[model samples]
Target: MIANFSQYGIKKLFLPITSVVLLVFGSCKDKAQEKPTEAMVEEVGTADGFESIFDGSTLNNWDGDPTYWRVENGSLIGEITPETLLDANTFIIWQGGEPSDFELKLEFRISENGNSGINYRSELLDTIPFALRGYQADIDGKHRYTGQNYEERKRTTLAYRGEKAEISTQENASEPESLRNNVQRNAWQSRKVLESLGHMDSLKTKINNDWNEAHLVVKGNTMQHFINGILMSEVIDNDSVNRNASGKLGMQVHVGPPMKVEYRNISLKQ
Candidate 1:
């Protein structure tokens, strides 16, 4: 009887100790789950499906004005000099075949007065050398025109910085006098600002003459542009006649004062 009583007492003591241990570990687990610091990781360029396009030493698959475009310091550099100033913009095109639905990413730096851009889903003008007409992810040193969508030699400004626009076809679409760059072109397309991404001046504060990451997410009829990991502008085009789903890609150096633009780490995912 004494042995059985002692056994019962030992079990009673162990039951409370087991309960306390379980409660301690359970409380620690709950506290650990409350702070998910590991899950809040920021990701950049770590996504799948990306492939490097620029070889860093050669312009083998790119075509443009030899005098203006060159490989310098492991970057694709396009510069304009007093002797090479132009009456129109010029482009250094990518010959890597056009992308239909894809994401493009790269880093760029521009001179204080430089004006340049990334042109995609574009068609090279047969009548003009180094001229492409299509969608442009606009970039400029002034930051006033940076991060906008400008259709080169075409429908002009489709979406300004801090804007999200939906473009559709219309029977009669006219360019309002309030619109700038109504450059000798007309399109049966209408653009509606769906929402504001942010304030333009506030967004430009994130950009500078330093190296900035430029990302383009062009899928289906939607095209989004991001600078320094911030969304700058977006356009959803339903204008079938005016939109190009797939075409060539290129970089531009606009006509104006002598300026320089450098690009590196050009990558694409399709």
Candidate 2:
């Protein structure tokens, strides 16, 4: 009788131990089968109203010259290879709606000599294919022009890095196209620098060739550019005549030597 009872007790313990082992193995197997996801992608459905514009793996709703744009390793890349040099600036424009009052955020990394910019409140240039004329959040490899508010092919430089300025309408307004692309097109606009956000060199320390976050907050006549949470530049676009209230959004691969720029985590809050 004693031996029989001992055997029953051992059996009962073994069953529970075996069941626990099976459950452990099954849990691990299930987890291993699950695919990995990027943290940014996972946050797409979060409570925040910000929604991702880029799907990380595809450019389904984007328009650009395929020759210079592509997706690799979950990034939107634009490369101007030595063999595929460009004569004029090109862009990968977002096919989504032209957000008028919105906040834009993204992560970007550029090659040492790379020159790129984010165009907002912009319109497609009829004169040049893949070109834009509107407000730009300027970016470059050296951080020289990074965080600046430039009106590409339009009013020119609205505010430099570390500047808070107001762009007002000019009576005799018309900044004609010049031989140089960066030439000031303030013909019918006047910029009054309100104050210095900070020193250029001091603010530049917040940027690098590595991935960095850029934030653009444009509501009504006010536009703000932030690099890594620092207010780099701000512009009050009072130039109602030339200001673009709403238009397309695009990323630029400026005309220059061979260079590369990668963008990811593109989210917009309208």
Candidate 3:
């Protein structure tokens, strides 16, 4: 009787153990046989009431020189080699739509010689493909020109960094003025100079060589530039001769040395 009871106990334990093993193996086998799920494509979404301009995977609504522009790692990349040096500055014009009273934001990184800008309320030049002629939030790898309000192919240098000036076309009105770079506050020490004026520094320190946030707010004739949450420059464009009310948006790759610039997370609200 004891032997019978022992045999029954062994059978009971073995059956349960075998059942568990079979169940686990069956589950694993079923999972393996199931088709692998396809990866979901990322859906680009708007941010802070701003609509996305670049899908990050394709240049669906951007127009530029294909040799220098591409989408890589989710950034709009513009690169040029010494052999592909351009004779004039070019742009990747945004085709999604033009903006008037709007705010534009994006992230950018440029090589040491890279010169680029965010052009808004700009018109395309018939002389050059993808050329813009209007307001540009100027940027340079040297941090000398970054965060300045420039008018491309128009009244150049509307306002410089660390400056709060009003520009008007009226002969009696105050013309474009700037706090010219000084020895102690030269391009290398731009941040210090701006800090002295309680403005966002244009020093390379505020910009990560890898990536930095650039924000442009344009409402009517007043435009503002900010970098990494710091106000770098502002322009009250009362220049009746050159100020634009509305036009296309673009990204520029200035003609000079061989350089590269990457931009992503571009969004605009109108």
Candidate 4:
């Protein structure tokens, strides 16, 4: 009788353990099936409410004379034509007709020795005037001064490249105990020098060459600029550099006859 009872106990334990193993395997399979579906959904719904401003074939949303801008290979190419400068007495302007607070994203590729920029909150001028009056995001094919903020019309640099070692050393020498407690934290990766106020802040990683992405967000009394996924500048509206609540957007085709800049995938969201 004792041997039979012991055998029964062993059999009951084995059955429950085997069932638990099967249940776990089934759960893992279900999770594996779910992952791909989630990814597909994300891929399709990525561009929420943003609308494409450039059609890749023509300049539809923008209003400007044909002599200043053209469409080629799916890019809005703005050039400084001899005729345009001579006749217009200034740069050509592309008016989108409507303006509001919004975010703008565009990809740009610069020809060698190329210097160009995206102009936001700008106005057409009888004279070319200064490039820094409105809000211009700096572009240089060499990446030497790319992503620097040129407060257009204002003629001041809001930010520039930073030095990492100097910032780290200063912090460490001043507060040894703080460094010990925060040793695991990363050193300043990217530097942004605010020339107007003489302030510097760390930025996201710098982007160079190739096609660099610029994201500008303007909302109410504040503005922010991001490059290649790093916040490069933040400023409040004051008399020295206050942009109109709304203004025209323009692209610069700097003064070299051979220089060419291509812009595409421009979209805006409000």
**lDDT (tens digit, per residue) of candidate 4 on 1-270:** 244547668664556777768867997988888775767887677656677777799766565546656889988776664454422212334445535588889888876676777777765564543222356666767665566555454323544533211111223322435433432322222223233322233342366567778888877645666777776555444332234576667777565554567788888887
By TM-score: ranked, best first: 2, 1, 3, 4
Clashing pairs in 4: 132-151, 132-152, 132-153, 133-152, 133-153, 133-154, 134-152, 134-153
Considering every candidate listed, which one attains the maximal TM-score?
2
User: RMSD in angstroms, all models?
Assistant: 7.9, 8.5, 10.1, 13.3
> How many steric clashes between backbone atoms does each model show?
0, 2, 0, 8
Error of 2 at 43 (Å): 10
Between 2 and 4, whose TM-score is larger? 2
Off by over 4 Å in 2: 1-45, 174-189
- Could you tell me which 10 consecutive residues in candidate 1 have the lowest summed lDDT? 179-188
Superposition error at 169 for model 1 (Å):
0.6
TM-score of 1: 0.78
**lDDT tens digits by residue: candidate 1, 150-223:** 88877788888999999886433334442333333432137889999999999999997799999999999999
- Candidate 1: stretches off by over 4 Å: 1-47, 172-189
| lDDT for each candidate structure | 0.87, 0.87, 0.78, 0.58
